[model samples]
Target: MATVNLDLTPIHQCSADGCTFNASASCHAPAITVGDHGANHCATFLGIPTKHSPTNDGHVGACQLSDCSHNADLTCTASTIEVGTSAGGGTECLTYSAA
Candidate 1:
Protein backbone atom coordinates (compact mmCIF):
# COMPACT_ATOMS: atom_id res chain seq x y z
CA MET A 1 0.00 0.00 0.00
CA ALA A 2 1.06 3.56 -0.67
CA THR A 3 0.32 6.74 1.15
CA VAL A 4 -0.03 10.24 -0.16
CA ASN A 5 0.65 13.45 1.70
CA LEU A 6 -0.98 16.77 0.95
CA ASP A 7 0.77 19.93 2.14
CA LEU A 8 -2.13 22.29 1.84
CA THR A 9 -2.03 25.40 4.04
CA PRO A 10 -4.27 25.30 7.07
CA ILE A 11 -6.58 28.07 8.22
CA HIS A 12 -5.17 29.44 11.47
CA GLN A 13 -8.24 31.30 12.66
CA CYS A 14 -11.53 32.48 11.24
CA SER A 15 -13.79 35.10 12.82
CA ALA A 16 -16.70 34.54 10.47
CA ASP A 17 -18.85 32.72 12.96
CA GLY A 18 -21.93 33.09 10.79
CA CYS A 19 -20.44 30.83 8.13
CA THR A 20 -21.59 27.22 8.03
CA PHE A 21 -17.99 25.96 7.99
CA ASN A 22 -17.01 28.02 11.00
CA ALA A 23 -17.01 26.62 14.53
CA SER A 24 -15.09 27.66 17.63
CA ALA A 25 -13.42 30.50 15.78
CA SER A 26 -12.00 28.10 13.20
CA CYS A 27 -12.84 26.95 9.69
CA HIS A 28 -13.94 23.37 9.02
CA ALA A 29 -14.67 23.39 5.32
CA PRO A 30 -11.88 20.83 4.59
CA ALA A 31 -10.59 23.32 2.04
CA ILE A 32 -11.21 26.98 1.24
CA THR A 33 -10.55 29.23 -1.69
CA VAL A 34 -9.20 32.76 -1.20
CA GLY A 35 -10.18 35.11 -3.97
CA ASP A 36 -13.18 37.04 -5.17
CA HIS A 37 -12.28 38.74 -8.43
CA GLY A 38 -8.69 39.50 -7.38
CA ALA A 39 -9.74 40.49 -3.91
CA ASN A 40 -8.65 38.71 -0.74
CA HIS A 41 -12.19 37.67 0.11
CA CYS A 42 -12.95 34.11 1.00
CA ALA A 43 -14.90 32.59 -1.86
CA THR A 44 -15.81 29.53 0.19
CA PHE A 45 -17.56 31.54 2.89
CA LEU A 46 -21.25 30.66 3.00
CA GLY A 47 -23.83 31.86 5.50
CA ILE A 48 -26.43 29.20 4.60
CA PRO A 49 -27.38 26.60 7.18
CA THR A 50 -26.76 23.56 4.97
CA LYS A 51 -23.78 21.19 4.79
CA HIS A 52 -22.11 22.05 8.07
CA SER A 53 -18.71 20.59 8.82
CA PRO A 54 -17.98 18.64 12.00
CA THR A 55 -14.30 19.47 12.26
CA ASN A 56 -12.54 22.75 12.99
CA ASP A 57 -9.45 22.21 10.89
CA GLY A 58 -9.70 23.56 7.37
CA HIS A 59 -7.08 24.14 4.70
CA VAL A 60 -6.56 26.51 1.80
CA GLY A 61 -7.16 24.54 -1.38
CA ALA A 62 -6.66 27.38 -3.84
CA CYS A 63 -6.11 31.12 -4.04
CA GLN A 64 -6.84 33.20 -7.13
CA LEU A 65 -4.90 36.26 -6.00
CA SER A 66 -1.64 36.10 -7.85
CA ASP A 67 -0.60 39.46 -6.47
CA CYS A 68 -0.55 38.17 -2.92
CA SER A 69 2.83 37.31 -1.46
CA HIS A 70 1.58 34.07 0.04
CA ASN A 71 0.17 32.80 -3.26
CA ALA A 72 2.09 30.53 -5.57
CA ASP A 73 0.65 28.79 -8.60
CA LEU A 74 -2.89 29.59 -7.43
CA THR A 75 -2.18 27.89 -4.11
CA CYS A 76 -1.64 29.46 -0.71
CA THR A 77 1.89 28.76 0.54
CA ALA A 78 1.48 30.35 3.95
CA SER A 79 1.99 28.06 6.92
CA THR A 80 -1.37 29.23 8.16
CA ILE A 81 -3.92 31.92 7.39
CA GLU A 82 -6.55 34.01 9.19
CA VAL A 83 -10.01 34.96 7.93
CA GLY A 84 -12.23 37.75 9.16
CA THR A 85 -14.51 40.59 8.22
CA SER A 86 -12.93 43.05 5.85
CA ALA A 87 -13.17 46.81 5.98
CA GLY A 88 -15.44 46.58 2.95
CA GLY A 89 -17.88 44.52 5.06
CA GLY A 90 -17.20 41.06 3.65
CA THR A 91 -15.30 37.95 4.64
CA GLU A 92 -11.71 38.24 3.60
CA CYS A 93 -8.31 36.61 3.99
CA LEU A 94 -6.71 38.67 6.73
CA THR A 95 -3.29 37.24 6.02
CA TYR A 96 -3.22 38.65 2.53
CA SER A 97 -0.35 40.97 1.65
CA ALA A 98 0.76 42.54 -1.59
CA ALA A 99 3.81 40.98 -3.16
Candidate 2:
Protein backbone atom coordinates (compact mmCIF):
# COMPACT_ATOMS: atom_id res chain seq x y z
CA MET A 1 0.00 0.00 0.00
CA ALA A 2 1.16 3.50 -0.76
CA THR A 3 1.92 5.65 2.24
CA VAL A 4 1.23 9.37 2.47
CA ASN A 5 3.16 11.92 4.54
CA LEU A 6 1.56 15.11 5.82
CA ASP A 7 3.25 18.22 7.26
CA LEU A 8 1.29 20.21 9.84
CA THR A 9 3.90 22.87 10.48
CA PRO A 10 2.93 25.58 8.01
CA ILE A 11 -0.67 25.48 9.18
CA HIS A 12 0.35 25.76 12.78
CA GLN A 13 2.31 28.96 12.22
CA CYS A 14 0.30 31.16 9.91
CA SER A 15 2.12 34.31 8.74
CA ALA A 16 -0.92 36.58 8.51
CA ASP A 17 -1.44 39.17 11.25
CA GLY A 18 -3.67 41.87 9.76
CA CYS A 19 -6.35 39.36 8.84
CA THR A 20 -9.45 39.52 11.00
CA PHE A 21 -9.83 35.78 10.63
CA ASN A 22 -6.76 35.29 12.77
CA ALA A 23 -7.22 35.11 16.53
CA SER A 24 -5.04 33.78 19.35
CA ALA A 25 -3.00 31.68 16.92
CA SER A 26 -6.11 30.34 15.18
CA CYS A 27 -7.92 31.20 12.00
CA HIS A 28 -11.67 31.77 11.87
CA ALA A 29 -12.35 32.34 8.18
CA PRO A 30 -14.27 30.14 5.77
CA ALA A 31 -11.65 30.05 2.99
CA ILE A 32 -8.55 31.80 1.60
CA THR A 33 -6.62 32.31 -1.65
CA VAL A 34 -2.96 33.03 -2.66
CA GLY A 35 -1.42 35.15 -5.38
CA ASP A 36 1.86 35.53 -7.23
CA HIS A 37 4.85 37.46 -5.87
CA GLY A 38 3.09 40.64 -6.92
CA ALA A 39 -0.59 39.90 -7.03
CA ASN A 40 -3.59 41.47 -5.36
CA HIS A 41 -5.08 40.57 -1.98
CA CYS A 42 -7.99 38.26 -1.23
CA ALA A 43 -11.46 39.71 -0.99
CA THR A 44 -12.52 37.44 1.83
CA PHE A 45 -9.76 38.70 4.17
CA LEU A 46 -11.78 40.62 6.77
CA GLY A 47 -10.48 44.06 7.84
CA ILE A 48 -8.02 44.07 4.96
CA PRO A 49 -9.08 47.64 4.18
CA THR A 50 -8.21 47.21 0.51
CA LYS A 51 -9.56 45.79 -2.76
CA HIS A 52 -7.72 44.09 -5.56
CA SER A 53 -8.05 41.50 -8.30
CA PRO A 54 -8.38 37.85 -7.50
CA THR A 55 -5.26 35.71 -7.57
CA ASN A 56 -4.66 32.66 -9.74
CA ASP A 57 -5.08 29.16 -8.38
CA GLY A 58 -1.43 28.44 -9.02
CA HIS A 59 -0.46 30.67 -6.10
CA VAL A 60 -3.53 29.88 -4.02
CA GLY A 61 -4.43 27.09 -1.66
CA ALA A 62 -6.03 26.33 1.74
CA CYS A 63 -4.64 28.27 4.72
CA GLN A 64 -2.72 26.16 7.19
CA LEU A 65 -2.57 28.56 10.11
CA SER A 66 -4.11 28.28 13.57
CA ASP A 67 -4.68 24.85 15.06
CA CYS A 68 -4.62 23.32 11.62
CA SER A 69 -2.81 20.01 11.56
CA HIS A 70 -3.05 19.24 7.85
CA ASN A 71 -0.56 16.72 6.61
CA ALA A 72 1.61 16.85 3.54
CA ASP A 73 -0.86 14.68 1.64
CA LEU A 74 -3.17 17.69 1.55
CA THR A 75 -5.65 15.92 3.78
CA CYS A 76 -7.55 18.08 6.26
CA THR A 77 -9.96 16.98 8.96
CA ALA A 78 -10.93 20.48 10.09
CA SER A 79 -14.67 20.99 10.43
CA THR A 80 -14.16 24.58 9.26
CA ILE A 81 -11.48 26.50 7.31
CA GLU A 82 -10.06 29.99 7.91
CA VAL A 83 -8.70 32.56 5.48
CA GLY A 84 -5.62 34.72 6.15
CA THR A 85 -3.21 37.09 4.47
CA SER A 86 0.16 36.04 3.09
CA ALA A 87 3.47 37.82 3.34
CA GLY A 88 2.84 39.73 0.12
CA GLY A 89 -0.77 40.54 0.89
CA GLY A 90 -1.92 37.26 -0.67
CA THR A 91 -4.60 34.96 0.66
CA GLU A 92 -4.20 31.54 2.26
CA CYS A 93 -6.50 28.98 3.84
CA LEU A 94 -6.01 27.94 7.45
CA THR A 95 -7.44 24.44 7.63
CA TYR A 96 -7.35 22.31 10.75
CA SER A 97 -8.12 18.73 11.58
CA ALA A 98 -9.25 17.24 14.84
CA ALA A 99 -6.61 15.49 16.90
Candidate 1 per-residue lDDT over residues 1-99, each given as its tens digit: 222225889888999877989888888887888998987799999998774756547889899999999999998889899999976789999999999
Give per-residue lDDT, candidate 1, residue 77: 88
Residue 19 in model 2: shift from native, Å?
Answer: 1.2
Name every residue pair that clashes in candidate 2: 6-71, 6-72, 7-71, 7-72, 11-64, 33-91, 62-93, 63-93, 63-94, 78-96
Best by lDDT: 1
lDDT of each: 0.86, 0.40
What are the RMSDs of all candidates, in order? 3.2, 11.9
lDDT of 2: 0.40
Clashing pairs counted in every model: 0, 10
* Index of the highest-TM-score prediction: 1
